[model samples]
Target chain A: MMNVWTLFIPELYCLLMAVVFFGLAMSARPNPRRDYFAALFMAGVGVVVALACVRLEGTLFFEAYRVDLFSQVFKVMLAMGFFLVVCLCTELNGIEERHHPEFYLFLTTCTLAMMMLVSSVELLTIYVALELSSYSLYILVPLRRGHGVDVEAGIKYLMVGACASAVMLFGLSYVFGVTHTTYLVEIIHVLPGVIGTPAAIVGLLLVLCGFFFKLAVFPFHFWAPDVYQGAANQVTAYIATASKVAAVAIIMRVVALSGGSSKYLVDMLVTLSIASMTLGNLVAIVQKDMKRLLAYSSISHAGYVLIGILSMSATGYASAIFYALAYLVMNLCCFLVVVKVSHDGSDLKIAQLAGLHRRAPLLAMALMLAVFGLAGIPPTIGFTGKFLVFAAAMEKGYVALVIIAMINATISLYYYILVVKAAYLMEPDEELPRLPVSIPTKVLTVALVTAMVVFGVAPSYLLEVARAAARMLM
Target chain B: MIVPYSHILMFAGILFAMGIFCAVARRNLIMMLIGVEIMLNAAGLAFVAAALRWQQLEGQVFVLFIFAIAAAEVSVGLALIVYAYRRTGSLDPETYNILRW
Candidate 1:
């Protein structure tokens, strides 16, 4: 009983934090001030506290929610990401001052929902958790001040998200009708027997559609670029990193339903992977806006991650996990620079990065490392992640897929280097003064850059953990 | 004995398809929300019918949760509509493209 309670500590803490933040926001009188720093402090503490629970394992609520090695590992990654993002959000200039605490409230709620999402082993719980997170994000987008684009992105995100979830629910109904059970463990036991049937295949794919939307895979990825560009830089960072981490975890969970040898699922995954990589990389080449460029780049990376997932093996799952963590760090490093550079809280263009090295040397160096890592250049974690994922695909005899992935990588390198060149070689205007950087941001930049290279060169510890976590799903 | 399970499923499927069509075809934001509501209700109807056929309480329970979720989604959905309307002065999605590449 105590252990069960312990397993729930992180979620309870998050809920408490959200409620407390809301209360603080509501009760403030003449000052009308919300403690943004406190919000960041709580998020940082919450993640650190969550990290301590990595070893505890239990199931509660009639085994509907699982607190296993796999879930805990993902939870730690998510919490850490939440912490870093809150830190990065220290100055959310785009948001109105009074709404500061409310913003943190939504952020915590979304994070809490994601925490629940990974732990849920029941279908109904999964849907509810997904909605909770989705709704929170829907509200967060439009919170940006008086911008038609933000509202537009909010509406598009809401409508598309609602449609996708409805489609997913329609599929879930079929899954329930076919399997007659909503618990994942039971479904896993029964699915292999029925999965070869048309109903099972369709139902499973439909269920996957919800997660695919979150992951921004091909057909479901349309909202990502627009929303990324429309939302605040901090919100975009949260969406790109932490939300993506949750999507990867859930995708692994759902795909595990097939029980090892579903060729049809493999075919579907292959098609999505190839299309996402090709389309994402191709569109990214012409993107002028920094956020939109990163959005397409993220979509392409989603494709690379799929190569591991579709392999349907432990090595594949582990590689995907490694890649997700690496992607999170590299992407956040880039966003940190964007957040700092866009001092007025407006969208940034690619050309705006000209002479970043001269404006701020540390930032320029950090951005270089991130772009190099994203482009999958060697001695960075991105290369290691891609190599492992591609190797996993080859192990599964996906020769054609591997070749296409390589081509996408080459195409992606072009745009990534273009940004680097603008940052390093081109010169800024004479009048604009040097960009100011506080001590903490400088420290974070150093840490993020160092981690990218260190983890790339010596990935044994992370690889072993990832392999262990992947084995749990098997 | 009164109604076959296939008929219930067929009815639900048609309802769902209609809901999807309204959602995709309609230009008005409110109409799209209505379509989503219809789709969700169709899903609930299917779950209830399946529950009756299977004689399991879980399906009925799931429908109840769906209703709760659909309600929450609608409230949020409407609030967003109002928010967007206030900002853009129109409900048409065509006019709201600022971040296009």
Candidate 2:
């Protein structure tokens, strides 16, 4: 019982911090450094709380919230991810300050929401948690002033997000109507018996609609390209990485809880996975904006993660988590370079990176590594993640699915190399400004870039953690 | 109290679908934002209907959270709408295409 109470401390602390940040932002003289310090403190406390939860795993809050190895691992990763985003955000001095600290306040609230989401053992709980994370993003997206693109992006995200969520809730109601319970464990208890029923199928699809939207899979991914292009660079980085990881964790939980897969469910998911991969990668090749190119690239990567779910095996789940972690590093490295390039208040463009190598060799090299990793080139974590996810699919005899994913993976390299060539081989548009980055950001980028490279070379530790998480889910 | 939840759900669903159509089909930004809010509220209505039908606590619990999210969404969505309107002085997305970059 004592452990059960301690399980909620991270969430409670963040919630309290959110209110405090909000009040401080409204009442006091503006100090960006203090605000960032406060954010780091909140993130550090969150990390500690997540560690404590992992150390004290037990059913808590009437079993509606889980505090098992799975939730704990996800919480730690999410906390660290938020901490990095805060580090990147603290340096955004160009963003005009009209209620500035609200940024950190909302970020804390969003992190609390994501932590709740991973621990959720009920459909309704997940729904609320998903909304909590999204609402924060809705405000955060339009934070870029003098750029109507940011506003456009926010509107697109909201419109799509709201629609997908409604569809999800309607589906949940149907599931509740059929199962006569909202508890996920109970839902699992009853799923095998009603695997082919219309209500179950509709309910599950509806639930998936919300997540697919969040993950930006095909058909539901229309808003992503626009949003990525329109949002501030750092905000785009956070949205592209952390937002989707939380969604993937929930998707993994749902599939694992549903007793692997039925013919109908697996069949539907395979189609979605294949379509998302093909469409996202193919569309990404034509993109001119640096952000849009990466956005579509992310969608393609999302499809690969979905394929991981389609395997419905421990290896599959673990690989998906591993891949998500890889995607985080690769996407952030790319965004860090984007932030660095635009550090002097210049436009963020693919062509603008013509002579980055001449101006900043290290930045150019890091960006190339990120893109190559994204393309799944050799000796990069992207390759390792892709190999594991596809290998898991093959193990489960998803031959057609695996083959389609392989084809998509090979096709993705062209576009990724296109970006790399532009950075390295393209001629200069003048001497590129020497981006003056804070030491913290430089250290953070190096760390993220190192994680990507090292994981590709030696993935045993994260693989073990992913396996532990998958076992807990099972 | 068989308020005919399927019928209520269907009604909300149709309204929600219409809202989506409005969002996708219309070019005006504010209209699209209104459409989004409507869709969210429709889901909220479905949640309440299910809660009442089942006499369960979860649906109501979820609805309250949805309301909270909807409130947050509205504040920022409108702010963006106003910003777009100010820059272009027209809510037309075509005019706002300065960001195709």
Per-residue C-alpha lDDT of model 1 across residues A74-119, encoded as one tens digit per residue: 8888888888888787677888878877888898999999999999
C-alpha displacement of A339 in model 1, angstroms?
A: 0.3
* Predicted structure with the largest lDDT when compared to the true one: 1
The per-model DockQ list reads: 0.72, 0.45
- For model 2, what is the C-alpha lDDT against the true structure? 0.81
TM-score of each: 0.98, 0.92
Question: Which residue pairs of candidate 2 clash?
Answer: none
TM-score for candidate 2, residues paired by index: 0.92
Clashes of each: 0, 0
Residue A102, candidate 2: alpha-carbon lDDT: 79
lDDT for each of the candidates?
0.90, 0.81
Q: Which regions of candidate 2 deviate over 4 angstroms? A: A345-347, B1-15, B22-57, B60-76, B91-101
Query: Once model 2 is optimally superposed onto the true structure by TM-score, how far is the C-alpha of residue A364 displaced, in angstroms?
Result: 1.7
Per-residue alpha-carbon lDDT of candidate 1 for residues B1-101, written as tens digits (9 for 90 to 100): 48997788789889999999999899899999999989888888878877777788888999999989999999999999998887778988777766676
